[model samples]
Target: MKKHQATAFLLLLLAALVCFFAGREFLTMHEEEAVYPSPHLTIKKRLSDYFPGLKNSPGDSSVYIFEGQKMGGTLLILGGTHPNEPAGFITAVLLVENLEVTQGKVIIVPRANNSGFMHSDPQEGNPQRYSLSTPGGPRWFRYGSRLTNPIHQWPDSVLYVNPAGQKLSGTESRNLNRSYPGRKHGKLTEKIAYAIMQVIDNEKADLAVDLHEAAPEYPVINAIVFHENSAELAAVTLMTLQMEGVDIRLEASPPNLRGLSHREWGDFAKTRAVLLETANTSHGRLKGRPSATLIINGKDKNYMKAAQLGLLFVPFDEDGISLKQRVSRHLASLRALVSGLHELHPDLCIQLDNLPNPIEVQKVGIGPYLTPSK
Candidate 1:
């Protein structure tokens, strides 16, 4: 009896230690990340402003607006849809700090899925934060998960039936992309999507672009996916990018692929929507040891081997896909897309200035474009 009591006490003590550590990690994940915006920002609004139901919820996020004295078309840019893709978030931050619109208006949501930034994907071994050295000081940004944080909406079902009636794995229930044209009273991710849609409708945006990155091995690497309504703009943008010596492929959004941003946002908002993707080594499955260094430097030996094996869609060698290159591609694509829109509708032109061009940013790097915090 004494032996059994002693053994039970030890098990209880071990359980308590495990709980303690787990609770600490959970709390740490809740900490909010910050970004310094440019002085040119006209107004900053919250996602809850459009969807009152999401006020003060984990899904609530910021919307930065840069309006000019001249009246013209409105364009919406989204980043951090999938937080694991650092380039998307970083490029958005870079734009928030550097962009100054002179005609029409530009609305940016740097962290579209706010909850996703609060946690890392389970068992992925990804770094929680990555830092960059700027002229002012070292700036740190959170490395977040691919989907909405489970803590905000838990107990995934065996299967997820999206609002559009598409079926996916239970895990996709947490994917914000799969919850588009969202319901006002839907789950956490859907509520976020709904708020975004509200922003588009309320602002009467002329064009919407979603930024993202994929593993080199993914076939969609270095490509632009556009809705049918945006096909002409996509073609023009692709041709312009090619003319500028930037290799980019254009893919049409499959009508059957339900619930995607390119598909649903266009359908619901009647606005042209496009999604741009870049190659990122850190986000790839064949990446080497995951670390903050890898996220910044973007070098991975395994990806190099995969490239040699012809398994990667993008070129990978000793010079891995650096964060600078990825941001350059995204900013270039944004420029091309906006230019194409101006050509298509002269009345609805969104003119932007003071944005770092791809070639310039590639040469000078993202540090100079980042405004130091006061």
Candidate 2:
């Protein structure tokens, strides 16, 4: 070969080698993260069992069941509906690892949007994974995108119309939250939603709670959005939380907002539905230094500035809102909701024996409650 041609060939080969290695690294990152549940887990299944369409699909996710010896009320918890909110996922996982149901059942879906966990949003510069140190070793969980991976479900229209007849941005079609009461033959996200509905139906759930986090600047932060059917429960929950020193606001689900879990689940299922929101600065647009530390610490200087200018919904200070605080708030609110439900319907009582209270979680941190990695 000519001198210039030989050099060009060598460069091409080197580029190809680099691309091969990079591609392998990217694919390997998609390895599924392991979640070890409490020894009390009675049953474990996949979302596909409810909607067979999701079998072997990226949307297929695990369902962890903890059934008490005696039959009673059933509670379903959804986590990672918006993968950008890490606290929701963490809280759900913590529940699975630590909770021991005594007089009822608890169902946990730690990765509600399972497909979303396979990839991160482009240009978001999000960490691919975050690690938590356990007594045995370090365990890592995927830091996923806010929406479903487009590779699993494609072709967004200009304005996507949901099964609920609500129009949203085309990109929102990939959001699991906007495709509730989903159809079995619909898109991947819709199929996932449909499967969850099936679980609620099959399990005869009494209450369903979806955990989420919003940007610190958003108005809905640190609040519970409950369906009309859950109004009495919401009121009682709010009162109990206040008595426990957790000042949480309760907002009724908007009638016009279609396809949301709080609305659709309540409308379709016999279960009362409530969605909880916590303040997450890392996901805020005003966040700086987008790193795992920012996600865990929940601290952002820009958010502090925004708070000073009265642009934030939640109180943001130099100390910042840590992950522990957000998780504690969610857990506390959930306990209050369950207590309210028990009071209203004595026959459908769910007696949870050991849940780390907010005060102790804030004082001792979440590590103590989480099961050690194996």
Candidate 3:
């Protein structure tokens, strides 16, 4: 072979090798993360059970049911609405693996936007996975994109109009949180939202909580945002959390916000809807580097400096807010909300037990509570 022809052939072979490995890494993200449900889990269903259109789709996710022998009210907890938020997703995993319901039912959707879990946001330099040292071994979870994977629904519009008649940036059309009370024939993200609404309506849920996390600089950090119908419950929850030294604030869901879970779930399904927010430094733009350590340990020199400048919404210092603390905050808030609901309506009281204490979780960390993978 001629020298130039041989060189060209070698270069093509090298490119092919690179593409092969890169493609494998990319496809690994599509594999669902392992979550060992607690022995108390009664049944596991798919999102398609509610909305059949979602069957065999990337958006289809697992729904875990923990039903008690005695009949009572039902509660729905949604996690991973934005897959980039690790604490939200981890907390749901914790509940599924540890919680025991004794007098009511608890339904948890750990990956509400399943499609979003299949990819990381472009240009963010975020880690694709982070691991925790569990007693069984190391448990890894994906750190994915905030929006639905474009591969599932492509070609963004210049401007997207929601079912509520509200206009948003075209990119937000793929945000699961912004597609609530979704259209049956809408986009992939919208169909997932619709399926959640179906769960609320068909199950006759008395309460629904959507778990989320925000950048530490966001003003709504460590907050409980509830629909108008849940104002009293939220206020009580805030007070209870404060009394327990949790320092959570309460925000009422704005009526004009069209597609949010708190607004749409309450308005359409008649279920008391609330959303919880925790502070996550890993997700903030001000963080120094994007690494698995940042997502798990959450220590960053830049964030500490920003805190000193009064630029952050939550307190930060040499000891950064670790994943344990963030997950503990979410757990504490959930406990308070459940207690408040029981107080407000005796008939709708949902009793639970065998939950890990928030303080203990913060102290010992999440690794111990997580069940070992078989």
Candidate 4:
């Protein structure tokens, strides 16, 4: 009943209340984001189905398949390899929600790294989620980490070596991009990669595309990195994209690089592999305060200054690169790749029906193309 005792009790109660609300918000990130796929979706499977070891693990992710009436080659589109890149993730979602295949099969894994989506990277000041305005309502999606959540796979070794025997930063052990052609009994990330290789093998995918984003200052921004096996396909795609007024460049996957999708998929799975990168300010080091606005708008005064200093590879202006623009670039790149694929290999032609027109998507924004959350 003393005055100091009453004060202590009140302070403790206040702290408990704050923890309750904060903990609740943290827990909500584990809830699945509602994705409305188009009627053309023929089959939906889990990553675990391809690799039983991933069952009940955080690495398991969804796999959406769209097949045409006639048989043809299969194409695998992977996005969210690093969950922090929204454009890549959004493009995959757009295709699944709006596309129909009429000549071949398309397999999309929108969240290739499901564990990454469960949490955001630490000390980044990054927002937990971002929203897009759909005609039906506002649809929210996670803005997650680039690596697997340490909660699911912890204790980073002093050094990490991939299946291909290349050393990387210990933290990269959790990076899905660095764990390709994965191991069956390896860590969680490796298991996810192994499962993807299984899909490529079982589905007999003719081509595999990994969508990504990079900091504006990064040299590889707005680039198409192709394995040597896909050199011709990428060359044709570059011309096609350029003719469409999309500024793009091509980078050959280094022969020495190991554990990357573009490299391993071609060598191990026999699938032609390529990766597309768009510039993302929010994903950069010089970005201003990280928030949902920064993730969506991609405008940072710091980046503009950096661009003025010629520090950025991609153009950065007061206009800033909007999410819609980045998504449009990705969609156009995919469209071009598919076009080039059919051109080079008649037997592996993949046709897309109702693929969102990139120009229209840019003009009207991504909201119109995205199906409302059910």
In terms of lDDT, the best-performing candidate is 4
Instruction: For residue 174, give model 3's deviation from the true position in Å.
Output: 0.8
Q: What is the alpha-carbon lDDT of model 4 when measured against the actual structure?
A: 0.94
lDDT of 4 by residue, 239-346 (tens): 999999999999999989999999999999989999999999899999889999998888899999998999999988998999999999999999999899989988
Any idea what lDDT model 2 has?
0.88
lDDT of 1 by residue, 245-357 (tens): 99999989999998889999899899999999999988988887899988877898898898889999988889888899999999999999999999989888888888888
lDDT score, residue 243, model 1?
98
What candidate 1 gets wrong by more than 4 Å, as runs, is 1-22
Top TM-score: which candidate number?
A: 3
The parts of candidate 2 lying over 4 Å away from their true place are 2-8
lDDT of each: 0.90, 0.88, 0.92, 0.94
Q: Which pairs, if any, clash in model 3?
A: none
1-374 per-residue lDDT for model 3 (tens digits): 99999999999999999999999999999988899988889999999999999999999999999998888789999999999999999999999999889888999999999999999998899999999988889989999999999999998888989877779999999999999999899999999999999999999999999999999999988899999999999999988999999888888888898999999999999999999999898999999879999998889999999999999988999888899999999999889988999999888778788888999999999999998766
Clash pairs detected, candidate 2: none
Model 4 segments beyond 4 Å from truth?
A: 1-19
Stronger candidate by TM-score (3 vs 4): 3
C-alpha RMSD by candidate, in order: 1.8, 1.5, 1.2, 1.9
Task: Give the clash total for candidate 2.
Answer: 0
Return the TM-score for each candidate structure: 0.95, 0.96, 0.97, 0.96
lDDT score of residue 81 within candidate 4: 98
